[model samples]
Target: MTRRLVATGLVVGLLIVLLIRTGIEQANLNRFDRDMGVILTAMKDEIIRAEGGGVALDSFVTQLPGWQQQLETIPPPTNSGYRANLLQSVLQFTVEYGKMADTQPDQARTAEMVENLTQAIAGWDEQLRNGPGEAGHSH
Candidate 1:
């Protein structure tokens, strides 16, 4: 029964392809997670250091565009809305921080900006730990 053998071969081939695709997707997801963690943490730390007068905002401002580009370039895992949302939040953070640096906001406003950025970072971290639509996730 050559027909039967060919049918079985086709199924096996398709299963192999599926497995390879799944593995590739998993790898991509892992890379995205690792890279985003570092990027986001660095951003939060830089802002906190600047707010506390531990470091100048000049360096952080200089690095914002690169961070933004990296965020935009990293491809999220398939069907992962949380990862997509997290990237957007981080990108927005960079934009807001850049604007603040340009305008030299008042001390009170700086505090407010830091608070908002902290909350956003915390929320994204929680989502990354928990899943896309978890209780603590706002977006």
Candidate 2:
């Protein structure tokens, strides 16, 4: 019957649209994950270098601006509160680093900051994997 055919066509059209939307979302998610991984890894590396003392600490001063920019520019999913929270942690670290980098904080103080940053990164990563819940803040 004509009515049956029309109904089937509408359902099929909607199913195709749904599939396309899901694919697009998955692609976006993949890109976000890749970008975040690169930026976060760079950040953690710099923090580790700073903790090592000497030239590595000095390098962080130069590298941090780029790291911050990368994080700022990365396109997080528009609807994700968890991504925003993770980014907030990164922002806090950058702000803290800016404050302390100026004074050239002592090694012990730098170490303390590094530890806090590492812990915050871990917490955020966990939140990202397990869904948003009470993320621990370092700053």
Candidates' TM-scores? 0.76, 0.78
lDDT (Cα) of model 2 = 0.70
Give lDDT per model, in order.
0.72, 0.70
TM-score of model 2 (CA atoms)? 0.78
TM-score of 1: 0.76
Candidate 1 segments whose C-alpha is farther than 4 A from its true place: 47-62, 76-78, 107-109, 135-139
Candidate 1 clashes between residue pairs 3 or more apart in a chain or in different chains? none
lDDT of 2 by residue, 32-93 (tens): 76787787777667767767765776676667788788878877675566666677777677
Query: After TM-score superposition, what is the CA distance of residue 95 in candidate 2 from its true location, in Å?
Result: 3.5
Distance from true location, Cα of 128 in model 1, Å: 2.3
